[model samples]
Target chain A: MTAPDDTLLLIEDLTVSYGAVEAVRGIDLTVRRGEIVTLLGANGAGKSSTLNAIVGLAPRKARRMEFSGSDLQGVPPETVVRRGLTLVPEGRRVFSSLTVDENLMLGGAKHATRGDPAAVKADMLERFPILAERLHQNAGSLSGGEQQMLAIARALMSSPDLLLLDEPSLGLAPQVVDQIFDLIGSLRERGLTILLVEQNVAQSLEIADRGYVLANGRIELQGSAEELRASPEIQDAYLGA
Target chain B: MDIFLQQLLNALSLGGTYALLALGLAVVFSIIGLINFAHGELMTVTGYAICFALIWGLPFPLAVIAGLSVAMVAAFLMERVAFRPVRGASGTTLLLTSFAVSAILRVLFQNLISARPIPVSIPASLSGVLTVGPLHLGMIQLISIIVTLVMLLGLNLFLHRTMAGRAMRAAAEDFAVLRLMGLRANSVVATAFVISGLLAGVAGLLWVAQRGSVDPLMGALPVLKAFIAAIIGGLGSLSGAVAGGFLLGFIEVILQAYLPESLLPYRDAFAILVVIAVLLFRPQGLLARKTLVKL
Candidate 1:
């Protein structure tokens, strides 16, 4: 929950605006190696905005934004990807018309060595058996939870050091949501530093090492999962306790 | 029957040209999601570049290479200056910009040469005929059909099997997600325009060889037909574009054979009607394109 020496992602005073509308107002956050940092909020709480801004998908004027010692300030999305930061965008943005195999093939294009994409694909299928079952089927026809799993597996295909997942559980059955959280929890165990943004605060905290509560484009509360879970403010807003 | 064979050859030749040009258009469309209005001008740019190469005392093959290369440079410049920055600017803005790019390129060529069509002298080597079984195919038509088939096959292989091709397909499916693949969007788009110019240039050459003339406005028909063919084939699929082109070409030539003299004059109109039918019914085109996830 608290790491003193090793920091994987550090963002300080990040401000994002769309035209005159400010989406994120000067938020600071950190995620250490092998940690799952969850940003939780309702719709329009800037959770997605903060996650996106970290990867430069959102245009936020940040005073300091660094990932694994690299300045991700002006890098375009693809460059950000090659730098080992991958975002599984909201709504599982897989190429629907592409076959499951083709989607995975495109996922590995970022690597310097086009390493056996087939092997990576095999690994991905092993992790998500539903995808393996539908290997030849068009990606668009997959069920919502399966689509989300594919999205995560596709991101993993890039072998990213830090994975940003936005709303992976927004539209799925409760069982699927639990499966996704378990998957995220296991990914953290595998040494993947993750920035998970979700509306499901309690579920996210259950998996997250550290958690940040975002409201009105600012970090309303931040602490270890247990601290945040125990906080009276969060309990009142999120847990219904 | 001899004439029917000739017209069948005619239909294939026309189809080849249409497919090549439509491919160029489809490349841009799939990569950037722009129905590039200037793509026609890129074809015109091809024509004018060929005219220039001939004027400069270059050999025909060399002239064609130079023409295609110049067209690619022109296309690249257009993307870097005009298309890329405003790429996400909206369909209307892109449409207007593409038209403007086309108009500007057309005018530049006109002012550089003349305001009229220029005759492209075909080398004596390319002028001949071949007799095969029941059909006698002109060298021009035969060569056009062969080259076009080869190009289409090559494009198909490149798109499905090769890295760059799959990247193009990936870009077509989701340009934003392509960033996750660590491939630059600009490079993918530039590849599209480059291929577009190359094929369009080849089409310009085959067209000139067949017609024995080149004009600044020569690209108008092929461009229009390819776009229509692409729409008919299913707006963004490569094979569909080719299928649509051949279908349109066959339909046009066959109508000429079967229709009354008055209706023969409306061949272009008839071709457009086929496109309209496709749009009205199979809006996803021949292949039925599908998206991956909305939620």
Candidate 2:
């Protein structure tokens, strides 16, 4: 475990619930700066709930939740984005009705008050050339892989210090998934801290510096990526080895 | 032929007013997914303001401005006070809340002022008719059409070019995602109400000009027609509302013009029958696109 001082994001005793149903229960985790941390889980393991809670999308309570030393209690989702934490939501919730360019522009809207949105947009277009090619086209017209790319590019337009990605590889073809994982690896190389929630355990572990397995609203396992890959339980449950 | 042209112009002018009212309702509906039935009360409130302004010896333009301002303020208050509390409630609940609000406003107007019609003097310039070549047109009709056109153009530019306008459109798509872009929920919803109010105010002015009087219940029929227009256009589409309004206006005018004198009294009933027929054919409405509600 990283020291508390070095931790960029720290969550202590966090819980999330929807009405009477508890989705996440008393989880503690930390992501130090510039690390790709993966949360591995099954469909109902509360992975999405954890990410949603951090960004204020889900009902949550925590003993201590801080990002870069700033307390995150009662902060709204927009403020969370403004504070340099951006989430690429599940199923690539790209604004399908809007043009590709408009989606990118909206992504940069949060930073528009503080920085040059035009510059950020230009950078995103350069980074995701496919988005540039289809700038005038509606986002819905894009193929699944392309839409996924647009979703990531849109989040990057905010220039967030930390990126929370939920199921980036949910329904993509194998080759497209490989491309997305490579993109994730490259983003890490650029020093963006990432909290990745994924079902593709093997690929996530390959890029993740650390991994946590969640089951039934609790963290079942936590270790470095190599240790997780070698574990017999992980092999049996996720890898099918 | 000249009489036919005159009737067409008249129909177009009436259509313009209905279009404005429908557009207002559609704007509010698109953003919050609430069919704000009290939208008509905005017209009622504006009509009262105009009457009071004229009573105070204010000039016609100033009276119109007063009416517009009052309607805008009322719209903002409606959202902040009545609608905001019940936001995210069931569709039936929202509809009932707006209906209750409409009833309250009507009652307030009746008790505070007069239940009877209050005569409003139209400026002579507006009341006059203009004849050019073979065509004749009422100045008020011309002004109403022109104003509606200008307002529509302005609204189009705002929605297409401005950031706030884009945010409003995005809110229709997924309001939560819009918040993730760092927009304040209050500001976006408030903006929708403001626009709705402005449209209602202008429509009210035209409506009063045509009727030559204002009463506590003056907004009821026009608002109902506007609701029909919005439904015909597609509940959540702005352009559809305008199109639907114009279509409804044309249908009413045509029925009134062409129907025998004996059948003139049943024109409104016939118009509703036509709307019902159209709905039977296109249940989702004329321009109904599939809009996915986000989870």
Candidate 3:
């Protein structure tokens, strides 16, 4: 359902490097509005770096980085969140010391001054019943899937317009992965823009309106999810036999 | 019996001092995860500022305000320039920089002091005396204990009730995640240090008033006590630091009162032994989560 001209993210000559080692090499990519755009790639293919750079985590040289009409090249990560961009970083970095409710409260911080935080929390608890049951428990005690839900819920607390997910299915059981991906589908259905960096290329592409296969810090192929799924290049890249 | 009551009162007063210092240190360290060696010097600087103001014939209240403001501002600047850039560097680097700043500040303070201990005079109304049966005490200790309690309560409320305080706590948990909450990590850290400096400022004024003398090395004992208390309590728990402070104070005072006269000078040594035992036995203090963090 994404129009070709409705761009949500624009990266022009975005070259990110750490000292002599470049991570994202002047990759120009555009994510259209209101769609699940998956960046599928191998571990060292620079997909994570590209996402990190967009979120202001990478220390690099960017010629231009802008999201949804705002300049983001020099902006810090906090400002990126305020401008409606949230990244569920790799490894599910939940605040292990804080309680589940506390984590949700922290996630809802950006929205605090904007409206009623209590209401947002109640709503999030409604959406994730597992979180509601464990609201008072420390996040570290939760199972891996529950932690991922907590992370996503916390990021959602800020009420971000665009959600960037990095490997949400990294270490979860197959059944739990389905639940997480299901949550993603639900989130997307509610009109949340998502730029996902996922390892499960088949499923990610299945849900993705468009997909980009990145290899060695550059985009190897880009097309509709169906087109990319049917291509031999993607099959060779992801499912090498 | 009379002397016992007197020693208990003295112990409580001492506890108040340590609690304030440790609380400030714990709050700042929790946010940034570095032992700010310069924290003691920040206290010394505030004490000198108050002393300097009193020498200039400023009113006692105004002088204290000026001193507290100056200390908070200095700590705020230290964060923006020095700590922010090297925040993610090795802990050793931050420790060295903080120690260097501490030494430099101490030298600067020593230069400003005359040969004599200047009288940090307060208003007559503020320095009233009170008697309880056989124990005679000045109003300053009572005022300090009350103020410390109020500040601790205020801090608790701030941490629990306010949005900014949640940001500060979240920043302590994970800076990257807090950033996703739309908080600038540096600003959050600055706020914490500024509050710490404010605590140092109040503690400094109380210290010089209680002793009625301002020495260049006055900060050493208090800072040392704070570090010990922090280690004995959990390093990250504010309430634990306060409890450790009171406990340290009571231990020191009880030993000073009950120990044989010949061992009087070593009373401080006894309190330190307790600190060491606590550290050896319960290395994580009383409140930290027992998680194995990867270095």
Q: Interface root mean square deviation of every model, in Å?
A: 2.4, 4.2, 4.1
For the second chain, the TM-scores of the candidates in order are 0.92, 0.95, 0.91
Q: DockQ of all candidates, in order?
A: 0.54, 0.39, 0.39
lDDT by residue for model 2 over B1-295, one digit each (tens)? 8777877888889999999999999888888888888888899888889989999999999999999999999999999999999987889999999999999999998999999999988888788888988878888899999999998999989987887888887787778777777777788999999999999999998888878889989888899999999999989888889999999999999899899999999999999999999899998789874633222
Q: Which stretches in model 1 have alpha-carbon errors above 4 Å?
A: A1-4, A110-138, A141-143, B1-8, B52-59, B129-136, B283-288, B292-295
Predicted candidate 1 versus true structure: per-residue lDDT over A70-159, tens digit per residue? 888988888888788889999888888777777777787645213466687788888888898998888898888888888888888888
Give the whole-model CA lDDT for all candidates, comma-separated. Answer: 0.82, 0.89, 0.81
In candidate 2 chain B, what residue range of length 10 has the lowest lDDT sum?
B286-295
lDDT of 1: 0.82
| Tens digit per residue, CA lDDT, model 3, B1-295 | 8888888788788888888888888888887787887777677778778888888999888998988998899888877777888887777998888887777777766675653466677767768888877887779988887878887898888876787777776776677767877777777888899988887777787787787767667787798898888777888677788888888888988997789999999888888888888878888886664432221
After superposition, the stretches of candidate 2 with alpha carbons farther than 4 Å from their true spots are A1-3, A110-114, B1-7, B132-135, B260-262, B291-295
Find the 10 residues in a row with the least total lDDT in model 2 chain A. A107-116
Per-residue alpha-carbon lDDT of model 1 for B1-295, expressed as tens digits? 8778778888899888888887788778877777776777777777767777888899888988887898788778888899888987878888788888877767876788777878877888788888888787788888999999899888888887887888888788778777777777778888888888788878877887888776667777778888888888887777787888888888788777777998888977887786788778887888646664544
Question: Please, what are the lDDT tens digits per residue for candidate 3 over residues A1-241?
Answer: 2224677788877777877888777787777678999998889888878877888888756656678878888888887888878899898888876788878888877542244677878888999999999998888888888999999988888777788999999989999999999999999999889999998998899799998888778888899999988899888777563
Model 2 chain B TM at: 0.95
Candidate maximizing TM-score: 2
Q: Whose lDDT is higher: candidate 1's or candidate 3's?
A: 1
What are the clashing pairs of model 1?
A: A91-B295, A96-B292, B234-B285
